[model samples]
Target chain A: MDKKGNPQIDLSQSVDFLVFWGLKTDVKAFCNQNRREKTVQLCNLSRTEKTMIRVNNLIKNYKKVEALAGVDIHVKPGEIFAYLGPNGAGKTTTIRILTGLTQASSGSCCINGFNIEKEVRQAKQQYGLVPQAINLDQELTVQENLIIHGWLYRMKSSEISSRIDALLDYVELLEKKKSQVKTLSGGMKRRLMVARALLHGPKVLFLDEPTVGLDPAIRRKIWALIKKIQTGGTTIFLTTHYIEEAEFLADRVAFLDQGRVVALDSPERLMESLGAWAIDRLVEDGMETVYFKTRNDAERFNTLKSEQYTLRRVNLEDAFLDLTGKKVK
Target chain B: MIHGIIAIYFREMLILRRRLTRQIPSWSISPFLYLTAFSYAVGHGVEIEGHTYMEFLIPGLIAMSSMTQAFAIASEINIARFYWHIFEEFQASPISKVSYVGGEVLAGMTRAMLSILVIMALGFLFGVRLNYGLAFFIALLLNSFVFASLAVALAMVVKSHADQSMLNSFIITPMAFLGGTFFPIDRLPSWAGAFLNLLPLTHASKAIRAACLNQPVSIFSYVLLFAIGVLFFSVAVRCVEKAKD
Candidate 1:
């Protein structure tokens, strides 16, 4: 016991305690107190013991073309992992395979240790999917759609009713519950989809371009909602073509290009590996981006005085362009 | 599996309830028109096999209407697939193939039962009453089961609404007119009668007419309808499994 009547937890046991309780704020506070070793220990524990999604050497082949070739990814619990790519770059294909909508040609995947192909029902119970298409039944009211989802998940009637109320409120769609899906605006429909996906309290949530067609204002609201969901301890696997969305939302980002992952890291680290600042020059054919170590270095580049160029912070798009020599659409 | 089937059936019932105001009227229109036209035009004093022509035609309409209404579920399935994309949601869900087929088949059967009731009411208004017994319902149930299972199977295989219409023309329309619905197969040539006897609907119409007329219902016809229903149900389940792939 400590002098102030609080229990003095041993260093070795505190890691397990914090992890078991999943008190992110307390862990962050402890990590801030110069506990580098403990922080590393906690991270390694999470990486090894708490992988929410694990994919190893996944490949998908169509009749003539390979959509995914030897892809691997490991997503940590309660973190937002983004799969960024251009059009037809296998982002949706990977999501489809992981969600069990498509089968991989070779490799294996597991959700929370349940092999998707072998233990399909158990694996499916571990995650919820918010697909890109607005596939809600337009003839049914928003509340009815959610009720059907709850029943499919096999929840009790009472629990389904309670969760419907809570989730509709969580997504800020409580007022629109009685309205038909076709009557909803695009943003409202997207929000309702999120609510329906979360109806069963899944351990993992798959968001396939959740904010794809929404305006910037609504997109920002969705971003906030995603962050809130993460805080509630749901692991998020997001796939999108929007570079800035990944930069803003993902804790770790994987850049997929032509059925291969070109780069994988935190968005900041991926950008920082090249440089901190970028200078874009209007070349003969298109924009050519040049990176520099510092803003002053970017400003004082000799070509800046002679050519029409602009300086800005390095972004994920710049990093992707650097790695693959192509832009993410 | 049971819960999944109930969930799917519940969704279909909700849609049916909401559209009932329009659907009930539509269900009544055909039987009403058919009864009025047949009874007035050719049935003033006609008798076939010791019964009025309306008595003969009522059971035929019952059989034919039940077959057509039950098979109409295919259009609903196609609309949910192509327009609403609700089938994708079912695919991603943890529900088994049998549960989905069961729920859809049940919905189809419900539509058939409702149409049969409408036809019976129309028959009553025409002053033609037959034995509404357990055998009559059993035959109608088997008939609905056959067509509903067939509907689910065909819905899975068709690529577009146009293809579904073509299937209706090729499979259902011909069966409705030629499967002993309007006239007894004995009235045709022996070769034509043998060909029509091969249809499941022929047995369905025969058994249904025999039961309503209080004649000894043929147990062979009952067994044949049940076997055809099971075969079509197996095919429907297989098609749904293939769809997932």
Candidate 2:
């Protein structure tokens, strides 16, 4: 119970109602103050918007193997939450469940106040997914991909046309709109994917390894686009094995290992909790890492090391390795 | 739900339009060769069931073309599943299983219809003509529906394109030749005719030939075809549900 005579709500169970009411209130206030005509009300944006993505005790069993063993997650509205794990660590499985592409063996999840199991259509309408694979229609033009996605969401033809142009411009692929997706460079295809996912203006955008195969320069470009999308108030749920990706773009990162979350916190907080500096030393088995609270302490440890070593700032990868005793990538 | 079906069908139509140039020649050439070789070389001046052999073969060819074209959807569905992964896109969307299967079945029907038109043109060039009436078209529609639904079901189960081709060789090829498409099944041994009678294409050919030659068309064959189509459609929907999970 609270001061307003409202019962105390467990955030995990009532996240949907909170998001709906908060968003409803926000929408009403924005419409009143600005009186914008073109602004489409994707949801009742003014009532209550809080946690945009919530997963509770989600379990997925594949025959004899348990792919996801009772995973739990909560992403706040407009927050960039990164899910970090290695291959076959249930990252893609979790994304598949959230996007309605696969069923969980147990537990429940909700997206933007809509239960994934009971209210599939409503839940799907709340989020747009950029899959790990380049699943765009390769035979279709860049513009056609976006148009088809918009049509699937049941947007009007005129709205689809205008939104395609705007999204293409946003991703800097306006010049290549007429080109077939197969002809575009890898980076361009990735940009087009980001554009396609945003065409319907979904409240939550799931990016599953959005920059996995791209080079350093292109990965940075995608990171910038991700930040841009976040600034527009769309909650971004990103999954990646790239440790640097989480450190660079995530407002909070969850470290997952063997289908279970080992740690969850902001990248800085995670690293700070370990140490301020990290030293990597070459050993017979593999590289071993040691962390220190200060540069002076790292230097003192360096004096005691006989093998080759490199001193650097502590990163999310170190925090992950320390927690799980395994490499993220 | 309907909008999702429309979206899938519209994309297929676009792809078909783009590949029409390369596709039309192949679609026409096979039937043209069949007409020239089988009708001219074998038929000559023969008659069967009070009609010339060419008249008899034309309707059979229409039935066969419709069946093969409808079943051709299996290959396309395989490509979408394994190579392009378009099925994943549909699974991720708000589209229902019914809409996905319905849209794909309709696309198969469209392809079957186009192939029938091509076969008819070739039949005309070979100096063979028959009454193209509502009943004839209706029989063709039912036949295409049966095979298209079967294709949708088979595609979900087949593991690869090689498996699809194997099915084509073992099932479809044998049915096309032995199901009274090119020759009279009655002329064969009674045992062979009894076995071929179990095939859907055999009923399709018999019903279509009756409609084209203005004979007494059997309503039972139409009912049978409709029943088989509905059954296969339900099976396809079930397969899609399983595959999506």
Candidate 3:
């Protein structure tokens, strides 16, 4: 209560009200007048919590087939968000829309607060993409490819040369800088794609199946590279069908089925919500799965089962199958 | 936008440099065969427009070579689009559609000029020389611009390599032979001359021939070529936008 018979509401207590009322102009002055510490904390919180990528009801249609039936996502800065789906589940379509390679039928999207439709150039400048296919210029050497990409982004020659060297060293392809892209192996080509994407220092990296066809050993190497990239405070939006890859790399996982997100949560939380263990029974018709809350319960059920059954710990794939009634791959 | 276009242009130049040896021989062989066989054998006793047969054939060969070289961009664009997916890289970047069309069109024009220079060198070997003036170069440039713009527009619409080859065989090959390259279109039947006049290459060949002979070149031909180039350039930008979308 103040002298004027009005309630003295603290700005810290109603941060949302301040934001909703468009009080950003007077925030600094109001904070300096009263509750300076609280206001500073709130301002810092808002700054740190800024969303890097935002999508609202994004939808795409190809004639009759609804490729993406309205997807909504918000990714924070410095977060690795994995988009998991089967083939033709709109994973690539959503990525294409985000990267501005294709236009959406409706809805809106933004990267680093720039609208993709209205502020297209600025939005594109905020992110880099590594497509599913090997889209490298086969006639050019690895160094030439990076140089051209840098030039496309309007980078200075001195900056491009230094950045190319750093990126090649980071991807462990420094020795192959002069080799033509066609001569590189599949894994090397994939690494080169990653290096090329990072050369411009984009705020967000969109990787469409970065390790799609690589063997397990090379896949692990790429996973390590992805983690290293995230450590540099760049947001990563990764699309892959490998459940284990999502579970191992993502801060949060989104499971899309038939152009809609069926489940989205942290991998541990999603797996834990289903059960701690699962039993796979080889039935007459097909393989049936049963989930149990504890290992002892799973073992008990396994012994009582007459048919062949194996008990194992619940993983992201189990959670996906349980949610969508289909496998990730 | 300019930087992105320069990047594309530089890449094409690098590829051209690497394939220059193979390209030079192929581009020179056709003109050599045309000059040695047509001018020396069939036209040894024939003269046209107060010039020797070899002198008349030189400017026509220049026009044909320029048209073919400029239109050759369609094959490169098709390869980039279908096999390498290089256009996707540009589409995903911040480059404008105009920049992409401009860069590719310029590359095509460069190829045309180089091929013209090669044909001119071969003309020297045959002891056939003509007026190499500002008007001759301007006509060649305008001619290249028209075909290169058309090539960019066609490249956007073509689906496969076979489609590109079909266009080369059916459209380009006919224009090269019948558009006054080997003979004068005025000597043909009235209906055939009218039909050939509709093709831009006919005007290109006439303007190039008149300029090379130091005769009065028609202002209408240059205007027509410029208009056609502008029309096709606009169409190419639109097609690029559609393809990206």
What do the candidate models score in CA lDDT, each in turn? 0.87, 0.86, 0.88
lDDT of 1 by residue, B46-97 (tens): 8878888888888898999899999999999999887887887887788888
Give per-model TM-scores: 0.90, 0.90, 0.90
lDDT of 1 at A274: 90
DockQ value of candidate 3: 0.29
In model 3, which regions exceed 4 Å deviation?
A: A1-49
lDDT of 3 by residue, B34-138 (tens): 998998898998989888888888889999999999999989998988888888888888888888888899899999999998999988877877898999999
Which whole-number lDDT from 0 to 100 does residue B156 have in model 2?
Answer: 91
Candidate DockQ values, in order, are 0.25, 0.28, 0.29
Docking quality band of candidate 1, CAPRI definitions: acceptable
Model 1 pairs whose backbones collide:
none
Candidate 2, superposed: residue stretches over 4 Å from native: A1-49
Question: How much of the true A–B contact set does each candidate keep?
Answer: 0.63, 0.62, 0.72
- The digit string of per-residue lDDT tens for model 2 on A13-91 reads 3543443334345554454335222111212232145568878788899877998998988889999999999899999
Ranked by lDDT, top first:
3, 1, 2
lDDT of 2 at B111: 91
Instruction: Please give the lDDT score at residue A168 for candidate 2.
Output: 91
Error of 2 at B132 (Å): 0.8
When sorted by DockQ, best at the front, the candidate numbers are: 3, 2, 1
